[model samples]
Target: MADPVAITAPTTVLIKVIHCIVGIMTAPLPHPTGLAYHRMGHCTGRHRWWRPLLGTLLFLGAYLVLSLVLFALSYGVGAAAGLRELPDGGHDFGPLANTALDLTSIAIALPLILLAVWWPGRRPPGTLSSVDGRLRWRWLARCLLAAVLPVAVLAVTAALLPDSGSDSGEFGAWVGWRSFLTSLAVLAVLVPVQAAAEEYVFRGWLTQAVGAFVRSPWFAVLPQAPLFAAAHGWGTTWGFLGLLVFGVVAGWLTIRTGGLEAAVALHVLNNLLGFGVAAAVVDGLSSDETAADSPWQLALADVATTLLYAALVLWLARRHQPRRLASPVASSPAPAPAPATTGRTVGHHGESGQDR
Candidate 1:
């Protein structure tokens, strides 16, 4: 017989390897007190200086490659289906098809952001969602309710007030109920995903990416704002300024309330309202005028309304007291030098069931 000791040695090695892999998979996330939304990335134990940087490269590559593929596929399909390319409709697609394509393109970032956190970043992805580890759905629902009324009021008020500077679309003949309802249904489903992805990219990932290096939330929040504005494409001066201000406000709210809930609530509602308006009228969706195309009056009112909405959210936050800072997971205080934080950590497999 082969020597028993030799046989046992190989088996022992296999066991040790299995154990090490398991340990990494289940390793607890750092639990740090006073971990703000921006600083959540720095709270993980696995954080090396290079992880976030590498992850960013991966993110850009993956997103660009996939997005190109998606658009090419969409273009091919649209052509097959007799969809009109602009100036008739979406770029190489029908209006509705192109709008769905755009919304879906933005939506993909949400998953990619989570993946970056899990692999190269080597932490629980939940930390990026909020201080509480996962998205606070209850809090998000409440915020959604809070935003609806003000946004509705403002949208109606703007419509009633005559269009200034001539860019806001004319209230043309109502598209038949079929066109309006179909567009509404599509917007309702995809708009929230699109909005949430943007929030995750700007408010969630960008802020925390910077916060991983800098402790200050303002420093973390400020950088993403301009990028957010630029992403919308420069239009009039007022419109660009409006986007910048909106970005700043959204970023601030993400930090102030300890999660993306408030920002997402605002974004989803705002997009739905805006898109709904475009859908309601003749060929309105065909016009590519975004929030970035707002004239001065609309831009100023948009900013003011955002601030007012922020104020209302702040009042609600005070009353509800959503957890803003990371709390330690271990019985003893988490080590000061730990790399990452939140109610949970990024796992290779799935999220910690505890925090959710």
Candidate 2:
């Protein structure tokens, strides 16, 4: 969904504050190690089989309630006011709308996830972000930068191919500068948040959920792949396979890097480009088509580009060696300050003496 996220000083400040919290949270763990990102829920060494199960339930119930409240507030109280949603008893969405609304719906999950972890899961909320118990913003930024190229490559490859999926031979008419720009504007804000939220839920929460029970990273990684694909709804066989591959690859990278940054980076860029392209053409955003709708050729292209992106990110990880485990190796204590030089010479008896 493409609900408009206002570009405001408050939002900017809020983001900065969040990054600041990461460092603060990561400051105290002593010898926090031998844990992968998937096992973060067990970071406190208090893993019950039912903790994540309960957190899941809490997240779902809260999500449903919050979604309703948000809809009511946005559509009922705001510009979409007075529009009746229910003919009989169902909720109305026509008043408030789609993409944006949908985006807003998913975006809220990111925060609620932390809450669920902190409360029901009985762990620090930051663990949901990484094994370090917080986001490593610098690492995330590097991944984000590394992510852009492959998505662009995918885009160019798609453009190079025939329009196998389009009904008409031509791409649709221009959406006009105003509409096009508006869509980009809104998408720019929403895509990153929505994509990151998915990573938190699937790669972060789901992986940790399973990892808490198992020792193998493969066990933690595989189950969420199908679920992630299923979340998009089955589109075509090839497309479904593509999404599955995407999920598996992304999950693996999340564990490999010890956080969700790589996954989130790729997802954010992929979605932003996809949405930007759709918004460029008439009725594009209105089209319900998603990554799940790709043809076999496009799906193949996606696989190639995605793999390439993963390789690139892994290479970057090697060079930078950002912590991919429970806690970064702590810095050694600063050497104690050198003793101040006394002007007097020390005696062989180890006493300070007057100049010899």
Candidate 3:
């Protein structure tokens, strides 16, 4: 039998990085018993009014750098493929190509967001996911399972709805199986990362940092919703409103559950199901088209579905004991007390004597 090799220092660091990544992916759903967002803010150390500003700047700076690198790489690929420029002087990577590239860029940028949280928040990276700074994998898995039904219902409802004249082409453009499968493969690998990245940035890092400054979870959660919606650039009032509602609900879940896991699960499942269905059924996956301007009935249906999902998650969370936030000191076991030592031991006759 070969002797076991010692773990090298580099190997240890790599393992930790992998662990943190996994934690980010598996943040649990919100539960009443979970730590409150306000309390979680306290875990990030002393609150500073300016910390959130700094954190935001750090995130944007890191993301910008990643975006530039991704764009350069994408341009090189288009150039290599001899892709021609559009009449507007922009290169047209086909729909599937564009979707895959966008997802890839998001996946690559996620780690930088984590880095921003770690650097400006001045806390260990895992705290961005939960109050305890560790992901509850089992809890996260449960939330993901809970998310499927609502997301599926929403996707199917959207599919069945009559398309408005606007962006009608988005629904009918079907790439061949080869392209579809390729896009599926990319989405399967990167969508979760992309979704989790958004949750970490808006629901996790921003919420906590802002919560710390304001000392109230509501202030932390509500204020970021518009910013979240703006980030989408949905290009329509209704689309913007929908995204704003989505962000607000996600923020509420984060506060109620005392962590980002529930919100992450909801976001991940929704994107995965939505994108997967689009790739399978739609003509072009890259273009954004939704029934945002549909009749009040359809919009109401969408809102109802979202509410149902949130209710189910909250109900399930009620059934289970909410996980208490683990204290940092408690997470680390105390060193075994050193054996009491004496310079000299009293002999049987009471004479001081050293033990051999």
Please name the candidate that would achieve the greatest TM-score relative to the true structure. 1
User: Which sections of candidate 1 miss by over 4 Å?
Assistant: 1-28, 81-92, 165-171, 331-356
Q: 89-190 in candidate 3: lDDT tens per residue?
A: 435697667776677766665687677655665555676776656666777887888888887787777768875456455566566788678878888888
lDDT of candidates 1 onward, in order? 0.84, 0.81, 0.69
* lDDT tens readout by residue for model 1, 36-100: 89988766766687887898899999999999888778767777887667553335555676688
What's the residue-level lDDT of 175 in candidate 3? 64
Q: Write the per-residue lDDT of candidate 2 for residues 94-135, one digit (tens) a residue.
A: 311457877888899999988888778867777877766778
Residue 215 lDDT in candidate 3? 52
Ranking by TM-score: 1, 2, 3
Q: TM-score, each model?
A: 0.83, 0.78, 0.77
Best-first order by lDDT: 1, 2, 3
Give candidate 2's TM-score. Answer: 0.78
List all candidate RMSDs to the true structure. 8.3, 10.7, 7.5
Candidate 2: residue 280 lDDT (0-100): 87
Select the stronger candidate by TM-score from 1 and 3.
1
Off by over 4 Å in 2: 1-27, 30-32, 71-97, 166-171, 328-356
